[model samples]
Target: MAEEPRDYEALMALYQAEKRRREAAEQNALEEKRGREAAEQKLRPTNLPEFLDACHIHLHASLIVQKNPTMSTQGNPDNAKNKLRPERLERWEDFAKHQMAIWDDIMASDFASKRQFAPLSALEQSGKDLRQQKIGSEIDLHIFQRDTVDKRVSSIIESMYYNKELREKFNLLGTVNFENHANMLSPESQLEEGMEQLTVHQKGKQAKEKQPSGSTDTAGSSHPRADQFCHRTAAFIVEYKAPHKLQLTHINNGLDEIELEDIVQDVVQRKVDDKDDVRRLVAAVITQAFSYMVNLGVEHGCVCTGEAYIFLRVGEDPRTVYYYLSVPEGDVTDTTGWTAGLEGPNRLHLTAVGQMPARPSTPSCGQAEKRHQSSDEESGPDPDTPSRQQSLSQPLSRTQKTTRGSSSGRGHHGERYHQIDRPTFLALMRRQLADDLDTDCDPVGRPGAIGVLFRVRLRSHGYVVAAKGTPAWFIQRLRWEASIYERLRPIQGIYVPVHLGNIDLETRYHYEGICELVHMMFLSFGGNLIGQHLTAENKTLVSEQVKRSADAIHGLRVLHKDLMPRNILWNEETKHVMVIDFERAEVEPISAKRTWKTPTGNSVKQGQTGPSACTKEIRRAMTELNALTIVIRL
Candidate 1:
């Protein structure tokens, strides 16, 4: 053995050969995995929910890595979005983990918000079902539902492998994609010739994979395949509710005109069609995504036109906005940055390089979503169980039994949503106002930041009626109003405006979760008191009302910070006077002294040294102001 030490060269060669053989084995195993995945993909479910559900049961569940807990809403109102530094982004995996955090929040926010609409009875009933042995336990219910969806998914996948099942269940057509199939917003774009032809992989109803070179590049696995590491894009939005990516619904392509910025402008200014809409929109969006997305291969957003959308879900805390054609791509490059030969939307792509698709809304011609008019797509009333809430749906279309590549003859599973009954409520208001406004050019009313007040015929009927929104900035005012009325409610004889019901819109602004835009109707004291001429009798009535109201609010431990001529309503005919608009109302500590700047620009004080420093003196001051306004008007 000692004499054989001279044979080191021969041993080195042998070692090299064994290394090559092991490498070959890894390559073969990788190829086998690719083949098995391809075969499975051919039998994939029709949409994201079904496919992901199946992926779960198949033990190949896609991972959703977590990121920061509270993204958009966290930190200072100052410096909210971390600036886009093409340097900070290191991995598609990190960006994805962050997005999952945000997307999870958005979806959860949506589901939880909507779940508020679900009846307690239904939730109670679900518990009862468990207690009654209808379901073995809470886990059993989950398992049952998962199993139902998984069974369907398994069959859809299996149908592709078994000719008898495939031939019997599906039409000899093509697979579906979510972009078009889940598209509930609008119509389909016209297809060009040769777009319908069957490629080698799509010869059957399922799609083809790994076609080299032309329109698609080594089309790894249509997004969200088992072996596919990156969720790639489309976290199930225009939206995503499921964990799968069967449909391009998971990824919304910025292929059409986007009105998202308009919504942003509206959110910022609280007005529709403002001149500063674009400037404000650009400022907000750029500020939000620039810091983070720049490093992720995005230079800036579509500043010329807002061609962007935010991806949010339940589990994640931060929501991310993606630029057009910018999505994470393959492993051609190392995990440290963008793939080889990858630039950005406009270059500077240091790390997370994304693909900006030069296409329209959908993924494929066969699986593309058919667009329709949102207002017109109505599901006719269901008479058997006509619950007003359940009768409404906006995005979900009526179910049609066509061959949608389901394993059974049934169509894709249709989801129903609740409709905000604005039309019915508005019509009733219009009629109520019509009977009240005498001859004031119908349907037109004076609009304000919080609400639109209509001079209704009801003023002559003794009270004023107004329909208005509690704006985000003015929410504190609304809460104050509610509290004041609730306090004044128990005090006798002061006119507290009678509140009618409010219709809640399911949609929310892009701010914090608490600030919702809701329309409330209140029976006020007078109609447009700002323009009203307070007669002698009206002065007497208003003086008495203000005096009592001021004194009442004090005993209730409150301060009506905003006091003006307009706030004290006057109905000359009925000599009815009432105070309104308690949004700026405050309930201060008994020992604390505070000065408030009222709407009239007067520095009124409870803590300051005014003639009326507290409530009892405040009423006397209101009486004097009422007298002066009445004299000035006359």
Candidate 2:
């Protein structure tokens, strides 16, 4: 057959086909290599962030960062749909590859030689701000004792980044009851024998007409009956160690055997009986929680019912409302019991039921009157039906509006969370704490996160730990911050000491139980350049430093998100400024092309008015860091 002369067209076609095959193979290989090595650079700079910048890593915690891949986890409100999608799987793979690169680099390099922890001056007893006056007004001065941090992050804890074989280290913490743990007090929804995602429920939405109990078992009910699938699962929350709360202040503290649900039952009964005082207090508490949830990217799963009790520590505008999912065995009341929940098609009904302000005309039975009204339209309003009030609470039209919030999923780029050993994390933190310096933000606190500031260790140059309570809402923010810093910790001195590592230990003296969320982070020391007067040399240095840090931040394709004075740390002693505070940081596209633009008077003057002039390619538009203007033009 080869004896026949091949045509020129046939030979050309064969060559082109071979060329395409080779190109495809090359592309696949290139992608595989990129997945193997860091596509750009490894995370955690080589001996990154010198002394002053290192100290703030504890104070601001997320101040330090290096170039690392972004992380995001897949989640759906419904538990059944919580598994990772194909895109999420790719992200997860990339995250693993990124972490492995760090480990490999750490192992292959002389990391030990780079462990010079001397950064900021040792913590002093007075705990006074070196530069007087508050920075953010977010810091709680009451908790600013010189020695408070020493009491935290005791000697026994191990680093999570260094410890490889964690076999016997947790012996002191007792048989770490991994399974026996509490999570937002949601009762166990353990499957009985065999439960599938598609449970053969035997009822429909209109099945409540025949029975008073609303318990009629209809064959193959359209409504989803799998408890696991129905429990409003926020899978992402548990991706990085399900955030757990040990204790919260109980509402009916005076009553010896009073559970949170009991207090709710009392409050609901009183409101039903036209108790104006109780109704006002209860409504205020619930409304506040709803507003808070809305701000944090949540829309449902809180209702005013006896089974789901809300314990409140109410006094100020920022009140603490604790959500307890289920009551004790005997605490279930007639108004709310085991089966009393928002279920079936029109969900969030229970919360809507008792939410309206009592009408003076029918104050005693306003809820009852509303329930009848709701049922008449819907045919069979199950006892667990969402009332008119609950529907009003999460206004259908409002939730439909797309919003970007702490709890809301960033669909295309879901926030990535890292899962590493506790000890391995502690090792990295132990190093940062070895170079601790105190940091303070707003004297009171940020809007969502609570009274928090990383207190420097007393006199000892040891690992600095952020000893502050963070709200559950802060978890996503903290995780986001941690991801940023973890990926970029290798970048040389880009941010202040941001997030160091996770800390979990057994404290002997003060907190008896093994501390849960003692996540350790190094905050660097340079104070913001607000109060300090600057010379010409210093002014030039500050501007250059600010621009440099901003450019570095932009290089990671992550926005400082907040490029302002409060977050800009200036160390007079070190003669340089470092960027801090990444709680609100967000990611965007990075570009290599640059377009030169003439600096206009408007662009320069906007510096005072805080006007941002957007450019097409790079979104770096804010007119900020004018030392001339910031010097307070006396």
Candidate 3:
């Protein structure tokens, strides 16, 4: 065949080997180019000269050195290398030097010129020369230097010279001009101008002095008179008179002796209206006298005028006029109702006798004794009694019977009269004991109780002790009171101690007996010592504590309807307080679904019940409690 096909397989192998060699060379060239680019991108210079050198090197490297095709395609050793001329290198060195020189000139031009301070320095030197020669003898050297620097120097130099006395003096020497002797004002002319100003000032002052005064003495002869008097009946003596004629007169031997007069003369002499002047004079006199009395260790028992009275006694004292004077009959009745059973007019009588001590005697005691002794005398039944009993014993009407039956159907029927005597009684007693233990003990005494006493019995020993029978209502009240303390126990450091014994219902009425006992205890202690009476500052503290307590009770709508002083306990050591007495607490839900009776007997729902309702209720309770405390004079 056609020369054995010329060994086609071997020829193909040779062609493939050549192709592989060419592809490897192209890849190598591309890798070399990429390496150069990466090196240039990452280059960094540490100094200015180094950075400039790097920039020159990069610029030259970026320039393309074109290949010479006229030489040989394979290799041309002689034409491969072409270098820059020696003159061009020399020219680049000169360009760099010129650039450096230009930079130096720019830096030099940035600095301010020295001519700005040249004139100032000349003036300062001339001033120094004049001062040395004593040419301007009247000029103050210290003042001139200070004014020249402070007023004339640039702010930059002033700040730099601050707090440096020598530097400031040097700056002044540089800034002030005192060498222009011909331009200075004459000392005689300056003195003449100053004299003219002084003369004008003096004339104005004289004119002002000659002007008539507008003041006049409106109080022609009024003078202040102040006096203090004490009454055995605790009455306040309010004296009203023209200040000039007012005097303190002592009634000894039925004759007046002037003890003090014109005590407040200066105050009364002030040009004021008669009412206002009198008030001021009286206030001054009272304040002064009060201070004097305090200094002398004399306590004021009462303060009173014809229309008002204030008592400062430790306890309820009938002899104190503040207790009785000008009080409305109804108010008095309401205030003193709690004491009715103990010392009311029905129980005790007082007759006025000449200078003799008025002794209290119970009018009902004799009548009670007579009734006790005559119990056996009434034994016979009369025919008139039988006839009267027949009418009284008539059968109840159908409607009345139905009403009575319906009332008994409810759980409250006869509940008040139910006796609490059983195993449950012991449980209740234990609960009461636990409550007493939980309460904080009062140092002075229990605030709202007649007395707190109990009896303890040991198993092996005889009865240890016993106390007087406490009223049933009082004990029930103590139970309610204990619940309040429990609710308030979470308040930090609030301590309210419930300390009392078991109540004896056999010998006590429910309501009146307990109320009287509480009233008596309060009276005995001068006031409720368990935070029933609080000052303005203490009231604020209590109000804040109550707010916190209310917040802690429920998220919002729960309110403590009764926020009285007796219900608030303060712990001084802990600086904390708590609210007690939740007997009147009611939950005001988000919806107005509850009804309450108004004082007028109309039913009304809690309006707009929400968190706001709770806050409002608390505020209202606080206000009502405050008003009640004030009315009771606690």
RMSD of each: 30.3, 33.5, 46.9
**Model 1 segments more than 4 A misplaced:** 1-446, 454-465, 491-493, 501-503, 507-516, 519-533, 536-545, 571-574, 588-611, 615-634
Query: Which of candidates 2 and 3 is the stronger one according to lDDT?
Result: 2
**Once model 2 is optimally superposed onto the true structure by TM-score, how far is the C-alpha of residue 220 displaced, in angstroms?**
36
TM-score of each: 0.26, 0.28, 0.23
- Tens digit of lDDT per residue, candidate 1, span 1-634? 8657758868888889999999999999999999887666444422322222222222111122122333111212112233322111111224344434432332233221221111223323333443332222212222332232223322332333233333333321333222111100001101111232222112111111112123211112111111100011211222111112111232232122234445455667777543343334333433333332222222222211111123211112123333332222221122332222344322112112111111112121122122211111011111111111121212111111111111122323334411123343335545544343234311121122243333232222222233344434444444445556555655412333433334332332211111233334433222224224445555555566566656666666666654544355443433444456665565544454656544223445555533244543455446545545544554
Candidate 3 backbone collisions, by pair: 123-177, 123-178, 224-264, 224-265, 439-497, 440-496, 440-497
- Could you tell me the lDDT of residue 276 within candidate 1? 42
Better of 2 and 3 by TM-score: 2
Cα lDDT tens digits, model 2, 480-526, are: 56566554554423344434443332221111111112332333332
Go through the candidates in order and give each one's C-alpha lDDT. 0.32, 0.29, 0.28
Write down the worst ten-residue block by lDDT for model 3. 347-356
> Given candidate 2, what's the lDDT at residue 532?
39
190-297, model 3: which lDDT tens digit per residue? 223233232211222122112123321122111111122211111112221211122111111111111112323534575455544433333332333232222222
| Predicted structure 1, TM vs. truth | 0.26
lDDT of 2: 0.29
lDDT of 2 at 286: 41
